[model samples]
Target: MSEAYTGGCACGAIRYEKAGAPIAALHCQCRQCQQRSGTGHASYVVLDRRDDLIVRGELQTWPVAGDSGNVKHNAFCPICGSSVFVTFEAMPEMIAIHVGSLDDPSCFHPGMVTYAARAQQWDRVGPGLKSFAEMPPG
Candidate 1:
């Protein structure tokens, strides 16, 4: 078995352990991501199977419509107000955790940049990554 991925909120109010490897890691520059992260972009490590992730502690969640018109449920730590994870209404099996919430953020190796058209010039990622003007086709 692969080593588990462990992490939590800034104040340790919420914690999680993923038994499987991440399906993908990427940076999103959509307006919602920018606003939620209080930055030009937000980084996430996505897991294909929600069952692989075990989360503890109460998380506050809010629903927001994505550019695709699908509702995304954003989960955060109420104690520290740290954005922790997101679950999509359109893709219930998937779970995305913020890279900043990881115990070892170095494990994140972003493969792509989404919503590049909305990306701010000041928040540029490495030039070598694949970038899409919008979400890539699945």
Candidate 2:
């Protein structure tokens, strides 16, 4: 990686850093993600390992049942209510950082869309990309 990815919540209360290249980056249009983001979709950059992720200050987390039937944990700054990160109950080690929370949003390159079935017909992700009704098999 050229420069290490570093970012924090909108309030700067929670900060994190990641080493190594990202495992996968995607735009999720699932119903659960839409509800969480209050937008058309949620953009996420997934890193398989959680070793280098560092959190500073306090981050409030909420575990929500996802449409995929997985327990999803969402993190944000208690002060700003900014959605920061997400983790899965089954795969506790992986970190899914919100693209909006990144200081450099350019670092995110979404390659696919998840939960395509639930995506609104008018609100589409893009023209071309892999689309899955649910998370593709690992």
Candidate 3:
């Protein structure tokens, strides 16, 4: 069996573990991502099911309208202010965890770049990965 994915907030106030593989991994260059990460982009690993994922500690969430017009709940550690994960109002069963929050961030293998149209020149993504101007259709 594949090893579980584990991670938490920088302050140890929040933690999470997922039992299965990720659904997708990508770097988002949307304006909100840039602002939240204080960088050109944010990396995430999308999980297909939220039911089996175990989480500990309180996460403060802020609601924001996504570029797709859907509401996204951005969850973070209230104490450390470290963004941890995001949940979609439209896709409640799915969850996207920040790659930086992972215990072993090297496990992230980004397959694509989202919001490439908003990507900054200084934060260029690798040329080999597929990129989309906006969120791609599933």
All predictions: root-mean-square deviation over Cα? 1.2, 1.5, 1.1
List model 3 lDDT by residue over 28-72, tens digit each.
Answer: 999999999999999999987788888899989999999778999
Query: Backbone clash tally for model 3?
Result: 0
Q: Count the backbone clashes (under 3 Å) in each candidate.
A: 0, 0, 0
**What is the number of residue pairs that collide in model 2?**
0
The runs of at least 3 residues in candidate 1 whose Cα sits more than 4 Å from the true structure, single-residue gaps closed, are none
Q: Which sections of candidate 2 miss by over 4 Å?
A: 1-3
Residue 72 lDDT, candidate 1, scale 0-100 = 95
Off by over 4 Å in 3: none
Error of 1 at 59 (Å): 0.7
Query: Looking at candidate 1, what is the lDDT of residue 82?
Result: 95
TM-scores for every predicted model? 0.95, 0.92, 0.95
Residue 64 in model 1: lDDT: 94
Per-residue lDDT of model 2, residues 13-36, tens digit only: 788887657877898888778888
Look at candidate 3 and tell me the lDDT of residue 52. Answer: 86
